[model samples]
Target: MPINADYKYIAAEIEFQKAETGAQKMKALRNMLSTAPTHKGAERLRADIKRRIAQLKDEIVKTKKQGKGRSFAIKREGAAQIVFIGLPNSGKSTLLSKLSSKKIKVADYEFTTTKPEVASIKFENIWLQAIEVPAVHEGYAEHKQGRQFLAIVRSADFVVVVVKEFRDIAKIQAELKKANILLRKTKEMIRFEQHMPHMVITWKDFNKKNLVRELWKAQHKIRVQTRAGHKIAPKPIVLQEGATVETVAKTIHKDMIRKFRFAKVRGPSAAFKDQQVGLEHVLKDTDIVEVFMK
Candidate 1:
C-alpha cells in the first residue's frame, strides 16, 4: 500500500513524543503504532514503537500508584524510599551495607538480590529508606523474569544505577534505553513563569543573574498573554492587602509552607520594602518574596 500519509503521521508522532508528557505521550505512541505502514521495512520499527508505548503505559500506571501512596509511605513513622538499580556484582550490597545496618547477602554473582530489601539510614534529623532491587540483565525486559524485576525499579522516587568502569559502555547504554530511564548528571533549578507553567532548565553552573533574567522574561510573556485575554495557567502570585506569609507559602509547596519563619518582600509594595516580617504579615500586589524556612 502507498505509505506517504503513514510516514507523515509517524513524523508527527515523533514530535509529539518529544513534547507531550505522561498520558499524552502514551496516547500518541499508541496512535503511531496503530497507524504505521505495514511494509516489511516499517514493520520492525512499528514493533519497536509498540513495545516502547507499552513500556511507557506501564511506567505511567506505576507512577500514579506511587504518587497516591508516597505520602503515606514516607510518613510511616520514619520512611523514605531510594531504589538501587544496576547489573550483577555492581557493589549494590556494599553500598547498602555502608549506608544502613541491614544485612544483605553480598555475592560475586549475577541475580544475588532476587528479592527487594529495605533499609533505614539516618543523617542528622533526616531518615531515608533504601530499597535494593535485583540486578537486571541484558534483554531482561523481553523475558518474564526481568519484567517483574523492573516493575519494582519503576516505583522508586530516586533511582541509582550502578555501573563499573571495566564494563562495556554499550551494554550499559542499551540497558538504560531498554529501561527507559536516563541518569541526570546535574540538578536543574525550577522556574515558574507568569503565563506558562513551571519549567526545568538544565544548567552547567549556577548563575543567579541568568536565572533571574529567564524568570523576568517569562513573567513579561505571561503579562502579554494575560493582557491579550488569553488563559494563563502559570503559578499564581496572589497578593491581598492583608494576606499572611503562611497563606502565600500554602499557595506554593505545602511541605515547607508550615515551616516558614520569615519573608523578605520586594517589588512595588512599599509597606514591605526591604523589611523582614513574620508569617502573619499581610501582602500586597507585585510583592516578590524570599521565604525563610526553619
Candidate 2:
C-alpha cells in the first residue's frame, strides 16, 4: 500500500511513533487515520488504523476486567503471584505445568493458551502462585488482546520471561519496557538499602531455590500457625520482624485484634514451650501461635 502524503496524517504518525504506552500510540494512530486522505495510496493505512484501535480497546477491557476484580481471577492473595511471559511456543506452558500442579493446555503450535491460567507452586515452605498468559509476538502490542495481556502482567508480584532461544529475549524485554513493566533491576532491587522505596520493575526471573528470596527482603514474612489447628495458612503472612502478636492478629483480620486476648507460642520467637504471652509478644519465623477469644 502506498503511504499518505497529507501533513496532518504525517503529524499523527509522528505522534504515534513518539507515544510511550500502547494506549497512547493507539490513540495517535486513530487520529492520524481519520485525517488521512482517502486516496488510493492510503487504502491500507485506514484498515491498519481500524485494526489497531480495536486491539487497543480490547486490551483496555482486559486490563479493566482484571483490575476491577471481575472474571479475570488473577488477584494476588498468596505470598506472591508470579507470571510467565514469552513468545508463542517458547515453553511457557511446559514450565508452568512443571512448576505448578494445575493442568494447563500445552501444544506445539502457537497461541494455544489464550487466557490467564492460575496455579500454585511451592517455594520451600512458602506457596507462590503462578499465572500463564497468552504468547506475545511481533505486532502483538498492536493487538487489543496483547494490551489486555499486558494489563495482567502489570498486577504480578514478580515476572518470569520465558525464552526458547537467546535472541528472542531482547524483543520481549523491549516490549515489556515500553509498557512500564521493566525486567531489569532498578533501585528497589536492593535489599540492604532499606531506604529506596520506589522500585518499579514488574517482572523477574524465577529463582532455583524455589523461594523468592527477593520477596523476603521486601517484606519479612513468618508462618503464624493457629495453636488450635497446629499449622499456618497455606501461605505465610507478611510482616516485619519486630511485629508483635497483636500486629499479626490485625493482619489476619481487622477484628482479630479487638477480639484478641492472649496467645500461646512455640518456635523461634517464643521464650518457652507453649509460652503464655501477651498481645505485644514479638513473633519469629515458623512460629506456632494460637489466639483465644473465648
Best by lDDT: 2
| lDDT, each prediction | 0.52, 0.65
Clashing pairs in 1: none
lDDT of 1 by residue, 201-263 (tens): 222322444543443332221110000012222223423246666665554335436565677
Q: Candidate 2, after superposition: displacement of residue 123 in Å?
A: 5.3
Output the lDDT of residue 293, model 1. 63
Give the alpha carbon lDDT tens digit for every residue of 1-294 in model 2: 232234354446545654555567777878877887788756776787788888888988887788753445455645666677888888878777867778789898999998888888765666777788888777766777777788777765566667766678678867766565555545444111222221222225444343344444444456555544444444345455687888766654344566666888888987888898888898987787766653
lDDT of 2 at 112: 96
Alpha-carbon RMSD, each predicted model: 20.7, 21.3
Span of 10 residues, lowest total lDDT, candidate 1 = 221-230
Tell me the lDDT of model 1 at 7. Answer: 33
| Full-model lDDT, candidate 1 | 0.52
Question: What number of backbone clashes does candidate 2 have, counting pairs of residues 3 or more apart or in separate chains?
Answer: 3
